[model samples]
Target: MWKIYLLAAISFLNGTSEYVIAGILDKIAEANHISVSSAGQLITVFSVAFGAGTPFLIAMFARMDRKKLLVYALTVFSVINILIAIITGYEMLMSARIISALSAGVMQVTVLTLAAVLAAPGKQGGAIATVIMGQSSALVAGVPIGRVVASHYDWNVIFIGIGAVGLLFSVLTLFAIPKTVAEKPVPLREQFKFFMRPRIAAYLLITFLWLGAYSVVFTYISPYFLDIFGMSNHGVTTALFIFGIASAIGAQLGGFSTDKWGAFRTLTGGMLLHAIALLLFPFIGQFAFLFYVLLIFWALAAWSSGSPIQFQLISLAPAAASIVLSLHSALGQLGMAGGAGIGGIAVKNGLLNYLPWIGAFTLAIAVGVTVLDKVYLNEKQFKETQSTLFIK
Candidate 1:
């Protein structure tokens, strides 16, 4: 359990490094003598690298000892961040971000896989949730903390801090995590075939749509708050804080619910609630209390399904757990990117009020997909059982 918590801490460090750049973009741009839009490309490159590169890395290194790989990845991740802290040129910063993204992607998949394999029976979901909580807590605290550090010192200082902590945790992970049996190296061609199965394919679709629904609204939430509710900067910040806290709590609750209620029920219930929460955003009008309550509930509902979704994917193909998880993680990044892209289109069309509705509609489609997949699976299992009984 303590080992799981330590993994979570490393996740927190990794997540902060991933997200804090968004908060300090202005500072970074000024330091590098680039426009802020160009500065934002650092984030785009990181996401693209993480989403497109991690699965290959995991497959390529499949035969390496899990413990050693994790340690090496963390060491590389730390060293990259430290290098970023000392670098001044835009091109150098972009190059460093790519390396950091790949390392962070590897770290995330390895951490989650380790948690799932190391947990006691029936506790895998809980353990995974604990690791996710680390990421969620970084969202809650990392950006604001980055802002504070940037206000007083250099923005690059945040990376240095993340690098220092990462190194410390690399040592901790080396000492604490026991070595596990290495996965047999799967050919890249064979690994891509995992996506061909119908159920697995459907599950991946749900992963994309579910996170896409959340990101569609969340990516543009500050502007939505300003345009729709006329929230001052302070007010928007306060709302974001609440949303972040709810998301963290929702992640922990998701694990508990998945363990207790089974993955299907938890997933179905969470998605339904998420859709309902978003669908009501426009109808809720100008009631502040109701708005805030709904905001928290929306965050809770949006996040609570993460553990169950991952649990289902792992259950689908335990033999290829790392491959599936890496793919799932990659798809999740794509989903967020897709959502943000779509939301940008809406905002460009002057459709800010409709963001929630678009998100809700996307979630509704995901819910339908989940339900249909469940029915198909149930019928298939029943037929298989009947055939066995008949033969007997």
Candidate 2:
């Protein structure tokens, strides 16, 4: 359990950097004498690199001792944050962002894989939940703190503080986590076999689509509030804080429901909740308090999918769990990129309010994929499918 928390601490660091960028984008642009749109490229570089490079990097390093690789990743990740704080110029920041993305990408897969490895029997879902809460918690709490800090002090200070915290957490991880390795060294290319099966591929697509929907709205949430509800900085911060709390709590709900009911039900319920909330977004803000309430439920539904979806993938391909999850992380990041693009297009077309509809449409397809699997894929067939997804 403590190990799980340690992993969450690492996730907190990764997620804070990943998310806080949005909240502090203006400060970054101003200090560097770049356009906010150009500063936004920092996020573009990180997400694209994380999405496109994660699986290959994980597959490339599949043979390494999991524990040592994790430590190295943490060390690099922490150092990179500090470097970004000290490094001058947009080009340098862009380079550091990409490098950090790669390291964080590896850490994302390794921690989830290790969480499953370290969990007590029958408690893997809960363990995953504990680890995921770090990211979700960061999205809620850490980013606001960073936003506040950046507003009052220097943006560099935020990164410096994040780096210092990351270093402290890495030290704790070094002592707390035991050295471990995968069951055996899987051939690097053989990892792609995890995606060979149709059912498994469908699960991965669902991951992509679910995350896509979330990112579409989230990519512009601050602006959305400011524009639609005329929210001020403090108001946006309050809204994010509420959503953040809900998201953290939602991870636990997803884990509990996954363990108790099964991944299928948990995922369906989560998607349904998300779809409902998103569909109402266009009309809900007028209600003031109800809009914030919807935001909470939206966030809960948005994040609650985290554990069950990953748990489902691992369950579907336990032997190649690492590969499956690596791709899951990659595709999830891609979905964020894709969703952000979709949202950008919507905004460009004078249809910003319709972003939720687009998101809901993606969510609908995601839910359909699950139903497609459940109706067409059965117990015996699933076992046979799993067998096909491995390299013997």
> What TM-score fits each model?
0.79, 0.83
- Which lDDT values do the candidates have, in the order given? 0.83, 0.82
Candidate 2 per-residue lDDT over residues 323-345, each given as its tens digit: 78777878888888787777766
In angstroms, how far off is 46's CA in candidate 2? 1.8
- lDDT by residue for model 1 over 1-392, one digit each (tens)? 99999999989888888777655665776788875446656765777788889888987787788888899999999999999999878899989999999999889988887998889999998998789778778878876677567757888899999989889998988889999866466687877798897677888889889988887777666556766887665676577678878888898799899999998899999999999999999887878999999999998999898889888889889988767876787888877667766776776677778889999999999999999889996578668889999999
Q: Which segments of model 1 are wrong by more than 4 Å?
A: 1-4, 21-44, 65-68, 82-95, 112-129, 147-155, 171-181, 226-236, 256-262, 282-287, 318-323, 347-353, 376-392
Q: Candidate 2: worst 10 consecutive residues by lDDT? A: 35-44
For model 1, state the Cα shift of residue 72 in Å.
3.4
Highest-scoring model, TM-score = 2
